[model samples]
Target chain A: MYNPQAENIIIVKDLVKKFGSFYANDHLSFEVKKGEIFGFLGANGAGKTTAIKILCGLSYPTSGKLNVGGFDIYKEREKIKRNIGYMSQKFSLYDDLTVFENIRFYAGIYGLRRKEIEERAASLMQKLDMKEARDKLIRSIPLGWKQKLAFSVAIIHNPKIVFLDEPTGGVDPVTRRQFWDMIFEASSEGITVFVTTHYMDEAEYCDRVSIMVDGRIAALDTPDNLKKHYGAGSMNEVFLKLARVKVE
Target chain B: MKRFLGFVVKEFYHIFRDYRTLLILFGLPAIQLLLFGFVITNEIKDARIAILDQSKDEVTRRISEKVLSSGYFILDKNLTSYKEIEQVFRQGNIRLVLVFGPDFSKNLDKTGNARVQIIGDASDPNTANILVNYLQGILSNYLISLNAEKIPMQIVPEVRMMYNGQMKGVYMFVPGLMAMLLMLISALMTSLSITKEKELGTMELLLVSPLKPIQIIIGKVFPYVFLAFIDACIIIILGNTVFGVPVVGSVGLLLLESFLYICMALSLGILISTITSSQQIAMMLSLVALMLPTILLSGFIFPVENMPWILQVFCHIMPPKYFITIIKSIMLQGNGFRYIALETGIMAGFTLFFIFLSVKKFKIRLA
Candidate 1:
């Protein structure tokens, strides 16, 4: 029943996850604040997915103290689940389902009242400028629109936080920018965004970024601050500098 | 409750919208029932044969009359020479040719012996064998009648076939078809659909939602259970109407037992989903582990009693084997729960065991 403190919505302390003596996540710790976009960055096989899974309640931590939305990870996993929304790297909407059907499905599982689901779904379509395409199956829509639709459905329940696992992978830059616009709009409505990405440019758009190397948090700061601290001119160079160091 | 209802509705959407699943769920049972009931049956009707009576005597003519009246064969031709036997068979219509030796009932009167030659087309071995057997039965009965007055003390054997009196092939294959179709819809299709969600990454999204793991699994199973039940009804109706196989037991009890078996199959599907993470792997495992084993070892095409010891042991472990047994007993023998309670109990036990095993495995894999 310990408090998560005033500013932080997520708190992790010495989170250790091991798979048969191999530490997929080794002694990790970080915090995400309310209404802030926190970017989680890592190279492939650097354990970012494992950490996100732990936070999302999809996996168990070997040993650690973790809390999200003021609920213990060990005791109140269900409460944590209720408070968060997630979209995976793959566009997770049903390809056979229409856009409105997809939205209603997520809204329904979140236990939204019928009238509320209807109102939100109509407005969600308006926001995406997809009212004309609302009845189209997800497979028939363009990739960019599908990605945006996926993000919109992920937050249909008005969760306190939305987790996007490399949400912009393989998307065009213009669409990625539009997607970030939606993210900014949600943050303005006080929905904290916790996202992971391989794109350094997307990392720069986040309020703060954490880089994990070899299952440990090697760097955590504002993108501009990290750039200045490393004496590099861009976040890309800053990433290259940290990732090239070999771990003993 | 509303939330769970919505989840089930979505599942139904997936099922109905997919044409492939629809075909397998509804179309397959009917196709299989017809194929096994009528087209591939073992019973013979109106087989054609030719007659060659060289003696042209009363005995040969009487034998020919009896053969035609048996209702199993048609007289394709009356041949006067032996060369016509080979020619009739080459036409592929005649299954057998009966030839009588030269005699006017003289040999039977003088030496108390008569000879007849039966030539059969063996291109299709099974039909040839059965045709020969039927001819033998007809000739032997005729000979018995002829010797009725001359025999001294004789012992006659009374032969009566119980359960299925005529050994109709539909009686045997209908129960087996029911087992295969139910398992296909319940276990194989359910496992495929569940793993499809995992492969598409929606399972991760669902897990991150408010729905509990058990609720998710149940929601996935409900639609398939309903579909499989409908399929079972279709098979039973077809078996009764088209094939004339009766449900001699209580109709309600038959449905209830089928429901129990469907639950067992659905739970096994969930267990398979827990172990596999991709649709292709789930599909391969379901076909290899469940479908093939059920069809081959469940006494469907082959009798479990006639199988080798190792295969018999395998059949005993097969869930569909017990289902086919229960179906045959209840439908053919007019048996009630008193007779098939053991199989029903075994299926219920499997349902519980699969549910428990999947719960434990799911927890250990994640939290």
Candidate 2:
């Protein structure tokens, strides 16, 4: 049972998003609790990214009662942005900058002092055991390391929630496993994670998952419960069965 | 504020690390100043002309000597017959042919008048007219000394050129150089910085950051202001030291105006970056849009006043035209801000307008 008194990290009610009269997110509603690892699963163009953009304060929902970290996205966008971290699928780290410099730059942009940036960078790099490659440029590092570093820098300010948009995309299984471990660590520290991914195995890693299809949440429950209800062997089978049944 | 400082420092790192940017920021202004200062000039030096001295008298020889010694014209060949004058003119090397009639001195004494024809190749009419006038002035000066005994019939007007008094090309070009150099650096920086973010995928990251749209723009523009200021200083120093062009107005005022113009140019760069998605397009757009107009329409090389009505109207719209006007007025004419208030105001308006448009475009993109 969801706690009645405990704070909801994200609250969305009747969200509607339109791009030139083409509805991307229509009448969508969801709630994510504090410190919860909420999985948002959808195929490409299911309005998942649009919904995330509105939540992250990058865009305005057409009509909605959207809240992130107890702040209204429309009224307190700047405050919301300050208290949330975002890592995009493209892995937005400066390729020309060294590992330490990238960390310092992001920390600075989040309004950390020079000394504070240095201190936090040292701790973050230490946590990742990246001391040997701190001076190396991001372009010189492997893709997996870059993704991990991007995620770490996103949360360097220690925000209440971190939004990961396909954070494990394109990485191998081992790297994806390591990326999820970091996500778990963040959630353990009372940081809510709102993630969207196509990887079904990664979906099982979340506490609760929502499968969106055609701008609507087709199914929402624990991965195990959904698998049991659908009588499927894995999350992938459940998702495939749901997708096919909707088409029929 | 701390985040803004960090962003600015990172911007400095971007500028300082790139060798191509370093060259454009520093190397270009210096090279352009040197070229404008020395190699390119409007002042004619040792212009070659042939003399057809039919009189061969002492007065004619003395007059011809005076013409050759003025440092304007060098005697290239002495023509024998009148037919040779046409051949020399056809060669295109001789700009002027000084023809003295057989009765040049006698006609001067008896009739109180004399004929000395200066036939110049009129294909390039402006240069030809200038050459003819110069030869006439030299010969008249010689005749004036001999005509004290007789009443002087023709009153030759004394002309004194001002500002670039000698009409040195560098003096004319220095202001142009300042506008051009600032435009090049500003446009290149804005375009490259934006495209670089797109290339590294960090633009999206910044979009997701807590920094406001205005903060990102201000942060990107800050380092470029410093680079443009340094370039302006180099151009001014080279203009004065190498080209002998004086800072006739308040040097402080000139610097202030230069800073304002740099902002205008940088704003244009920012505007260009807002529309362009790649570095190659930005560079090409800046070169074609900013560079060509700054050179041709700003009246740097071609006289905008003499251009067609439409082109002159077009030149009026260019930011460099205002900048060049202010620079020349302040640096060469020693005119104060009061004299160039309108031009300075126009440049300031342009800066504000560009900044506004860029911010609007940036915000729209974010939305």
Candidate 3:
């Protein structure tokens, strides 16, 4: 099902997001190819979230030529929204809803049919080995399970692109590994994975990562190439070296 | 439509799953109605009173009998001297003391005016004021009856409390309760629910989905419309059965007017959610902005005409004021649509205006 043409799933040229006098995402540009695991690496307040929000259509950019899933971010927000999925840093599942009900709700809002929603929910629960927790309330489950369930539900509609903002902030090493495995599985299935994280270790897992510093993309390339260029042994050292410089 | 239904079903889960919120939503109206009906009341029954009849004559005896037979007062003491009236009132059992001047029958026959002084315990001023009015009403009716037979030139200016003859406090409270409770449940609940989604970060997910902003708002508010409607019904039914408040006009019209008011309150809730970012702020805004006005300025407990000019202007702007008027006219006066057309129109106008404002304020993109 993957697109073989290697078309850019997201295109941004000179994007500027300003809040009053502050440039939250100042003069940023990047592109993500189809089915690519593109990492958005930045320290806190480095505008990774602002850029992601603009790209997800949750917000409007002050000035930009931007497109996501072949739809203009400005005039085609609804169309873009239908084609993209987002999971915020905060847990997205309703604590009151059961696992199955949460999945059904998200799928239903995406216009999935009743049979399709049921089938997908069952398959998703089985895939996550959470069939026993299907009828359990989200709050009764563990935080790791809730985060995993949130990501599964976000992409249940099979959107062309999925945005994960710090999806694995507090999960244990084992669950974080499982989460990355899930991301890789999704990326292999031709779903463009655009994720933001402060964890530099997670940066190495991306096929190509863009490091944003002070509202601008300071570096954009594959992990090995970035490590080689910066003369650093790890992505962490590379990020620290890049972020230490003040972008004036 | 299916998406909206799904959202509404989820909302029901949220409401029913939280037993505390559920209790507040359903139990509060019943408790408030009972409290206002039984505890805080204006109607008096079997109040202990003393009669100080100084004349001890036929006319005085007949008037005393009339006063005792009214069923509003039970004779606690009958004093022969004016000095005992103060002692009876100080004992506090007697809410009112009827003091008749000496030679009452001789004075009425010679001058056509008998002096019957009514002294009421003024510690509880509202009850005392109402008791005094009751005594005055009874005295006037007696005088009118006396004039019908003996005096042809006397003008007694007859007074009748139309719709609420006994002046039952529940008659006044049912409509006000409906307004206040409906505003509380509909506006406050919806605002909190929507703001809760924002606070929990679920709103970002929904906004990024295929669901439109209007759909999200209506879906959030739909369950409250149903809940608030049930609350309105509960208040009316309790007011009717427990307190014997009448629904003299059309029940359908009353319910329809209540539904219009609920819509107005629900839209007001959506407007609140759009302006606030958290549930606490939404709750505070709903209570401080909606509750106080519904109670104080809406003619619920206090009459709008009695308020100061500035407050009267505020009362005119209050939607509950119009809703209370509409319900009172329909439920008490047995009034038709024509009698409450203006109030109904104003309520509909408020609903539309709030809907318009919330729609305008609902941002597609996060600000």
TM-score of chain B alone in model 2:
0.90
Clashing pairs in 2: B249-B334
Please identify which of the two predictions, 1 or 2, would achieve the higher DockQ against the true structure: 1
Ranking by TM-score: 1, 3, 2
Of candidate 1 chain B, the 10-residue stretch with the lowest lDDT total is B36-45
- lDDT: worst 10-residue window of model 1 chain A: A1-10
State the lDDT of candidate 2 residue by residue for B102-156, as single tens digits: 8878887788677778888998887888888888778767767766567647676
Candidate 2 DockQ vs. native: 0.61
Per-model TM-score on C-alpha atoms: 0.94, 0.88, 0.90
Query: DockQ numbers for every candidate?
Result: 0.83, 0.61, 0.74
lDDT of each: 0.90, 0.87, 0.89
List, residue by residue over B41-77, the lDDT tens digit for candidate 1.
7878799999889899888889999999999889989
* Residue-by-residue lDDT tens digits, candidate 3, B169-248: 88888888898999999999999999999999999999899899889988988888888899989998999899999899
- Model 2 interface CAPRI class: medium
Residue pairs with backbone atoms closer than 3 Å in model 1 (clashes): none
lDDT tens readout by residue for model 3, A1-248? 23336899999999999988999998898888999999999989999998999898778889989999999888898899889999998969999999999999999999999999999998998899999999999999999999999999889999999999999988888989899999999998889999999788899999899998889899999999999999999999999899777642
lDDT of 2 at A193: 94
Give the candidate order by descending lDDT. 1, 3, 2
